[model samples]
Target: MNYETFENRVLPVKNKLFRFAFRLLGSSEEAKDVVQEVMIKVWNGREQMATIENMEAWCMRITKNLSLDRLRSNQRRATDSLTEGFEIRQETLTPHERTEIHENMQRVNEMIAALPEKQRQVIHLRDVEGYSYNEICEILELDMNQVKVNLFRARTTVREKLVKINAYGL
Candidate 1:
């Protein structure tokens, strides 16, 4: 793609790209690096994008691959900061309410983080990023049936954990 075309087509999807990267890496800094690497790779390979039907999905796949590569090379999963999360959330509620909400949010986050890698990725792409099943399948390079199954299991797992936490305070 030319400069103008790239600006229009690729640059606009940076937020989606960044969010997907952040979800995968769990660190904003690492996600930013991944997005930059994805952009560079896409730019360099612009010539090969001629027949691609979905550019966003293509870029997402690149982001997923690069993020996974980084994770593998480092031998660690990315971590989100609970304090940082609490700081950025809305403060409209009373202190007590806010604390409760924050605590619950942290619990949910922990539960999601504890999921297996594939389930985690599929859930993030589907729920957090709001992508359709087909898009998720494309981005994660999974078949449609696998994507649906993983997402179903991930949501079910999270729901079960949340119920347990609320019911018994475990």
Candidate 2:
């Protein structure tokens, strides 16, 4: 890929890359660094870019790998901020309603963070990033059955926990 093509194709996916990294690393700064590293790797491997059919999925795979590598090297647990990827702001809602929404979002994030790594990645790629099952399978290098199974388990776990929280205030 030439510089212009790189700029057009690769640069546009930076946000998606960063978001995926953040979901894995749980730190914006680390996510930014991962994104920079991904960009450099992509640029250096431009000669082979033509062989890749899905550029966005390719970038996402790079992001996932780099983020996991960073996580393993650091040996630190990843924790998502409540504000990440959540927007409860609404001008029309009363203060009480807004607070309720924020609380619900917080609970959801906590539940997601508590999931196993594979389930977490599958859920984030499918639900938060809006990737289809095929795209998620490609990005995560998993088979379609694995992707669907993880997604189903993640969602089911979250739903069950939410029900318990609401029913018993646990």
The model with the greatest TM-score is 2
Return the TM-score for each candidate structure.
0.90, 0.91
lDDT of 1 by residue, 31-136 (tens): 8899999889989999998989999999999998998998888788766643453463565778898778777778888888888889999998888888899999
lDDT of each: 0.86, 0.91
* Clashing residue pairs, backbone N/CA/C < 3 A, model 1: none
What is the per-residue lDDT of model 2 for residues 95-167, given as tens digits with 9 covering 90 to 100? Answer: 8998888987777888888889999999999888899999999999999999999999999999899789989
State the lDDT at 126 in candidate 1: 80
Cα lDDT of model 1 overall? 0.86
Which residue runs of candidate 2 sit more than 4 Å off their true CA positions?
Answer: 84-87
Top lDDT prediction, candidate number: 2
